[model samples]
Target chain A: MALLQVTDLKTHFFGRRGVTKAVDGISFDLERGEILGIVGESGSGKSVASLSIMRLVDHPGRVVGGSVHFEGRDLLKLGREEMRTLRGRRMSMVFQEPGTSMNPVLKVGFQIAEAIRSHERVSNQEARERTMDLMELVGIPDAKRRIDQYPHQFSGGMLQRLMIAMGLALSPSLIIADEPVTALDVTIQAQILDLLRDLRDTTDAAVLLITHDMGVVAETCDRVIVMYLGKIVEEAPVAELFDHPKHPYTQGLLGSIPKIDEKQEWLAAIPGTIPNPLEVPTGCRFSNRCPQVMDVCHHVSPELQVVGPGHRVACHLYGETGTVDADA
Target chain B: MPDAVMETRHLVKQFPVEGSRDVVHAVSGVDLIVLRGETLGLVGESGCGKTTMGRLVLRLIEPTAGEVLIEGRDLGALSKRELRRVRSELQIIFQNPFASLNPRMSVEEILRRPMEIHLRISAAERSRRVGLLLEQVGLREEHRNRFPHEFSGGQRQRIAIARALAVEPKFLVLDEPTSALDVSVQAQILNLLKRLQRDLGLTYLFISHDLSAVRHMSDRIAVMYLGKVVETSASETLFNDPQHPYTKALVSAIPVTNPRLRRERVRLTGDIPSPIHLPKGCAFHTRCPFVMDRCRTEGPVLQETGGSASHLVESHLVSCHLVDPA
Candidate 1:
C-alpha cells in the first residue's frame, strides 16, 4: 500500500466572486522513502495542495472533496484533537520562508523544544537535548551555542536548517516541504537538497516537495507531478519526464529554462499568462496557452490517462489511443 | 565593442554596527563596469554585497571610498545638487515590487510622482506618458486607475519598471527584479527588460542570487563573493569556462533541468564567512575547494587570463599551486 494516498482531493477558496478551485480534483500517491516533487508556476495550486494535506489551509479555504488516507487512515476525516495530535508527531510541514515561519521574540531552542514538548511527555532538559541533537543533525555548526540564540541571529540558510531540525525532530512518517530551498543560494540549495536526501535515507520517511523549479525536481525527485491552474496535467518519473515530456505545458516549462550548457536566442514562454482562478476557462484549462491546441480542446476536457507504465497525461492530443513510452 | 556606460574604481562601503566599534565591511574594494545597452549581472548569495554595489552605482547610498564614473563624470566628486541632477539619469527598481510601490497611491499616481519630481512635465502630459508607459509594459490603460493590491505580482513589477523609466533614465539598477515573480512571469519580465534595453538604449546593473535568470538576462556577468567581485567575464564565456573556483562551484550547483547530463554535485563545505570578521586572505578560501597555502595568508588581485583583458579573476586563472604543482 502507498504511504499516503490523496484521492480526488478538491480544495477551494470561497470568495465574494465564486469558488476558486485551487486544488481541483487532484489525485496522487506517495510511497515510503520516496521524494515526490510537485512542479508548477505560482498560483498553479501546488502550495495549496501541500497545505491541504497538512490540514493547514487557512480561512476562506476548505477541502470540498476527496479523501486523504495516510497509513490507511483517513486524514481528512480526523477530528480536531486527533488531527492536532497527528500534526507534529506523525507528520510535519516546513514553510517556504524561514524568516517568517519562526517567531521573532522566542529563542530558536525554545521553538524547537516546543515541537518536541508538543508530542512527547518529556522534561525541558530532555527537550533541549533533542533539539540540539536535531540542530547538529541538520549541519548547524556550534549547535549548543546557536541553540540559545534567537532566530534573527541566524542567517537565511541557517534559519532554513533550523526549520529542517524542527521538522525532523519528531521522526515523522512524512514531511511536506514547500519551496524549502528557493530562498537559498545555489550552493546552499545543493546542501539542503543533500540534507533532505540524507534525512529520507536515514529516517525512512517520505517527502512531498513543492517547487517552481524544474531543475530541482530533476536533481532530487523520484517522480514529478506537473500542476497547472490547480490541476495535474502530467505525472511521470523524473528521468522519463525530462526525456519525453508529453503535455505541452510541461514542455513549455522545460524549454523556457536556459540550460547552463545550451546557447539559445530565446526562452520560449507560453504565449499567455495563467488565467485568474476566479475566471478559469472551461473545457481544457490549458487550451488558451497550449501551442499545439486543437479546436476540439476548446469544448472538451481531457481526463488523465495512462499512456505508459507509471506515466499519465491529460491532453486531447492523446485522446484514447496514445501510448508513448516516457522513458524513450 | 561599446562604451562603458558606468564604471567603478575600488568601490568600498563600510557600515558601523550599532553600539559597536567594529564596522561591517559591506562592499570592499570592488571594480565593475556596465556597458551601454548591456545588462551586467551581479550574482552572489545573501549578504554578499551585490545589492550594496548596485546602490553604489546609482549613488543612492553614498560610497565611503571609490570613484563611480557615469558617462564620464565621477559621482563621488559631485555635489548634492549635481548628484540630484545625475539622479534623473540613473534609477533603481527594487527587489520587492509590492514593498517598493506606494500602497496609498494608485498606479497612475505612483508613476506620476517620478515625472513630476524630475522631469517637470505638465499634468496633462504626465497622464499621457503614464498611459503610454503602462501600455508599453503590456498593461491596459484601465490598470492605471487601480491600486497595486488589485494587480498580480507580475503587473506590480511592470508598474515599478514604468516608474523607474518615468525620468527616462539611461541607466537602471535592477536588483533582483524577477526574483519575486513566478517562473513564467520571470520569463516575461526578462524578455521585457531585454526588449526595453534594445528599444530605449538603456544600460542595466542586474543584481540577483538566481544565477540561471542572471545568465539568461545579462550580456556580461560578475560573480560576487563576500564584498568583492571574484570573477568577471562575458556571459557565455563565464557560463562555459568559469575561471574562479567560486564561479565554478556556483555554476556546478545550478541544477540543470535535463536529466541525461547529470554532473557530479560539488557541495561547498562551510558557511559564508562573517562580513564583520572576514577571513585573513580570500573571503571564499574558507569554503573554496581549490584552496592553496598562500590563499590562507595573502589576498589575490583580479588579473587578466589568456591575454584576454576582458576576463578577470582574482584567483590564479588556470592551474594554481593548489592543483597542478609542477
Candidate 2:
C-alpha cells in the first residue's frame, strides 16, 4: 500500500464575498520514504492541499470532499479522537514559521518533551533524555546546555531544527513539511534539507514537501506536482519535470527562475498576476496569463492526462493521451 | 577607470548592548565602490550587515565612524542644507511597499507628494510626470487614481519604483526588493528595473540573499560575512571561481534548478555567528569548511586575487589567507 494517498480532495473557504475554491480538486500519492514536492505560487492552494490531507483546515475553510488514506486507513473518516491519536504519532507536520509554531513561554526542551509525553506514556527523565537525543539528531550543538533555554535564545536555524525534532518526536511514518526551509538563510536552508535527506535514508519517513521555490523542489524532491489555482497542472519525476515540461504554465515557471548556471538578458515572465481566488477565470486557471493559450482553454477545464511513463499534465497542448470532450 | 558613483571608506556602525558596555559590531570597517550605471550586488545571510551597509551608504543611519562619498563629495562633511540638497540625487526602494507607502494615499498623491517636495514643479507638470511615471513602470495610467491597498503586491512595487524615479535620482539602494514577491512577479519587477536603469542611466546597489537573481542582475558582486565584505569580483568570476571560503559555501548553497548540474558541495557546519559575540579572528571561522590554525588567530584582509582583475569594475578582491597576500 502507498504511504499516503488523496483522491479528489476539495478544500474551500466560505467568506463573505463567496466561496474561494482553494483546493478545488487534486489527487496524488506518496510512497514510503519518497519525497513528494508540491509547487505553486501564493494562491495556488498547495498549502491548503497539505492542510486538507491532515484534516487541519481552520474555521470558514473545510475539506468538502476527499478521501485521505494513510497506512491502510481513511483519515478523513476517522473520528476526532481517533484522528487525534494518529496525529503527532503516526504522522506529523512541520510548517515554515518556527518561531510562531513553538510556545514562546516554555523551555525549548520542555516543549519538545511535552509533545513526546502527550503521544506516549513516558517518564519525565526518559522524555528529557529522548528530547536531547532528538535535538542532537537534528544537528543542534550543545543540546544539553541549550535544552532549558527559551525559544528566543535560539537562532532561526536552531529553532527550525527544534521544530523538525518535534515532528520526529514520536517517529512518524509520514511527515508533511510545508515550506520547512523557506524562512531560513541559504546556507542554513541547505543544512536543514540535508538533515531531511538523512532522515529519509535512516528511516521510512515519506515527506510531502510544499514550497513556492522551484529550485528547492528540483533539488530535494523525487517527484514534482505543479498546482495552479486549486488544480494540478503537471506531475512528473523531478528529472522529467525539469527537462521536458509540456504545460505552458510549467514552462513559464521554469523560465521565470534566474538560474546561476547561465545568464539571460530577460526572464519570460507570465503576462499577468495571479487572479483573485474569488474571481477565477472560467476554463483554465492559468489561461489568462499563458503564453500559448488556446481558444478552447477559455471555456473547458482540461483533465490531468498521462503524456509519458508516470508523467501527467493537464494542458490542452499535450492532451492527446486522454482527450476531454469540450462540450461535456 | 569608471567613475565611482558612490563610495564607502572604512564605514563602521556599532550598537551597544542594553545595560552593558558590550557592543554589536553590525557593520565594521567596510569599504565599497558602486560604479556609475551598473548594478552592484551585495549578498550574505542574515546579520552579515548587508542591510546595515545599504543604510550606511545612503546615510539613512549615521555611521559610527568613516564616511560616505557621492560623486567625490563627502556626505559626512556636507552641511545640513547641503545634505538635504544631495538627498534629491539618492533614493531607496525597500522590500515591502505597503510599509513604505501610506495606505490612505492614492497613487497620484503618492507620486505627486515626492515631486512637490523635491522638484517644486507646477500642478500640471507634476500631473504629467505622474502619468509618465506610471506608463514607464508598465502600469496603466488609470492605476494612478487607485489607492495603494487596492493594488496587488507586484503593482504596488511598481508604484514604489515610480516614486523613486520621480526625483530623477542617479543612485538607488534596492534592499531585498523582490524577496517578498513570488518568483514570476519577481522576474517582472527585475526586468522592469533593468529597463528603467538603461532608459534613465541609473546606478543601483542591489542587496539580496538570492544568489541566482544576483548573478543575473549584477555587473559586480560583493559577498559579506558578519559585518565585513569577504569577496568582491565581477559577477561571472564570483559565481564561477569564488575564492573566499564563505563565498564558496554561500554560492554552493543556492539550489540550482537543474538536478543534474549539482556542484561540488562546500558544506558549512553551523549557523551564522551572532554579531554581538563574533569569533575572535574570523567571524566565519566557526562555520568554515577549510578552517586552519592561522585562520583561528589572525584575520585576513581583502586583496587583488590574480592577473585577470585589470579593470576597476573587474577587480576580484577576496579576504582569505589561501589567496594572494596584500
Candidate 3:
C-alpha cells in the first residue's frame, strides 16, 4: 500500500457569500519515501489540500468529503484527540514564510524543543539535545550558540532552516512542506531545496511538496500533480510532466516562465485570473482560461483518465483520442 | 547626452550605527547613467545596495557625497524650491505596493494628489488625468473610488503605477516593482511597464533581486555587490558570459524548468558578509569560487573587458590572472 492515499478530498469554507470549494474532489497518493510535488498557481488548492490532509484547516473551513488514508488508516475518520496525537509525532508540516510561522517571543531552541516534547515523552534536556541535533542536521552553524536566539535574529534563509529543523525534530513519517522557499532569494532557494532533497534521501519520510514554481518541481520531485481551481488536472512523473504535459493549463504555465536561454516578446499568459471559489465554473474549472476549451468542457467535467504510462490528465483533450475544440 | 534623463557620479551613502562609531555603507562610489527612454536594471542580492542606488538616483535620501544630475541639472546643488521642482520630473514606484500606498486615500485621491501638487492642474483636469492614467494602467474607471484595501495585490500594483504616472515624470525609479506579485501578474506588470515606457518615453532605473525579471525588462544590467557595482553590461552578454565570479554564481543559481538539463550549482556556502564592515579588497572574495591571495588585500577598479566595449567588470580586471596584475 502507498504510505498516504487521499481519495476524493473536498475541503470547503462556509463563508457569507456561499460555500467556497477550496479543494474540491482532489485525490493523489504518496509512496513510501517519495517526493510528490503539488504544483499550481495561487488559489489552485495545492496549499489547501495539504492543510486538509493535516486537519489544520481553521474553523469556517472543513473537510466536507473524502478520505485521507495514511498507513492504512483514514485520517478523516480520526477524532480530534487522536488526530492531535498523530499530528506532531507521525506527521509534521513546514509552512511558507518562516518569518511569520515562527513565534517572535520564544527562543528558537525552546520552540524547537516544544515541537520535540509535544510528540515525544522526553525531558526538557533531552528535547534540547534533539533540537540541537536537528539544527546541525539542517546545516545551521554554531547550533548550540544560536539555539538560544529568537527567529528575528536569523536571516531569511536561516529561519527557513530553523523551520525545517523543527519539522524534523520528531522524525515524522511524512512532511507536508507548503511553498517553503517562496519568500527566499534564488540562491538561497537552491540551497534549501538541496537540503530538502538530501534529507529525503537520508530519511524514510515522504514529502508532499507544495509550490507554484515548476522549476522547483522539476528539480526536486519524483512525481507531480498539477492543480487548477481545486482539482488535479494532471498527474505524472516529474520527467513525464515536463516532457509531455497533456493539460492546456499545464502547458500555459510552462510557457509563461521566461526560459534562461530564450527571449520572447511576451510571456504567454493564461487569458483570465483564477475564478473565485464561491462561484466556481460548473464543468471545467480551467475552461474559462484554456486555449483548447470546447463546448463539452463547458457542460461536462472531465474525469481523470490515464493517458501514457503512469500519466493521468483530467481534460477532454486526452484518452481514446480525446479531441478539444479550438477556443476563440 | 546633456539631456540624459538621470545620471549619478560616485554616489555614496552611509547609515550611521546608533550607539557605535561604525556605519552601514549602503551605497559606495557608484556611477550610473540612464539615457532618455532607456531601462537600466540594477540587480543584486539583499543588502547589496541596489535599492539604495535607486533612492540615490531620485535623491529620496540625502547622499553623503557625489552628484545626482537630472536633465543636465545637478540635483544635489539645487535649493529646496529647486528640489521641489525636480520632484515633478522624478518619481519612484516602491517594492511593496500596499505599504507604499496611503490606506486612508482612495485611488482617485492618491493619483489626483500628485497632479494637484506637482502639475498644479485644476480640479476638473485633475479628475480627467486620473481617469486617463487609470485607463492607461488597465484599471477601470470604477476602481477610482476604491481604497487600496479594496483591490488585490496585482490591482493595487496597477494603482501604484497609475499614481506614479500621474506626476508625468520622465525618470522612474522602479524598486522591485513586481517582486511581491505572482508569476502571471509579474508578466502583466512587465508588459505594462514596457508599454508605458514606449508610450511615455520614460527612462527607468529598475532595481530588483530577481535576475529573470531584470533580464526581461532591462536593456543594460548592472550587478551590485556589498554597496558597489561590480559589473555592468548588456543583459544578454552578461547572462551569456559573466566575467565576475559573483555574477557567474548568480547566473548559474537560476533554476531551470527543463527536467533533462542539469546545471552545476555554484552554492555560496557562507552568508553575505555584513555591510557594516565589508571586506577590504573584493566584497565577494569570501564566497567567490576562484579566490586568489591578492583578492584579500587589493581592491579592483572597473575596467572594460575583452568581450565587449560595453562590458565592464571590477574583479581582477580580467578572467586570466596573468593578463592583469592585482
For all candidates, the clash counts are: 0, 0, 0
Looking at model 3, residue B230 earns an lDDT score of 83
Task: Report fnat in order of the candidates.
Answer: 0.66, 0.81, 0.47
Q: For every candidate, how close is chain A to the native chain A in TM-score?
A: 0.96, 0.97, 0.94
How much does candidate 3 score in TM-score?
0.91
A271-310: candidate 2 lDDT, tens digit per residue: 7899989988877778899988888787778889989987
**DockQ winner between candidates 1 and 3:** 1
lDDT of 1 at A324: 34
Q: Give me the displacement of residue B78 in model 2, in angstroms.
A: 1.4
What would the DockQ be for model 2? 0.83
For model 3 chain B, where is the 10-residue window of minimal lDDT? B310-319
Give the per-residue lDDT digits (tens) of candidate 2, residues B194-243.
99999999999999999999898999999999999999999999998999
lDDT of all predictions, in order shown?
Answer: 0.86, 0.91, 0.85
Candidate with more favorable, higher TM-score: 2 or 3: 2
- Give the Å error, residue B289, model 1: 2.6
Decoy 1 TM-score against native = 0.90
The residue ranges of model 1 lying beyond 4 angstroms of the native Cα positions read A100-114, A117-133, A144-150, A320-328, B103-132, B141-147, B308-326
Q: Per-residue lDDT for A1-328 in model 3, tens only?
A: 9999999999998998888888989888899789999999878899989999999999799999999999899999999999998888888898889999889999999999998887778999999998999999999999989999998899999999999998888788899999999888777888898899899989878999999888889888999999988889999998999999899989888877777877776777666566667657767778788899877787677889999888999888774233332331
Q: How accurate is chain B of model 1, given as a TM-score from 0 to 1?
A: 0.93
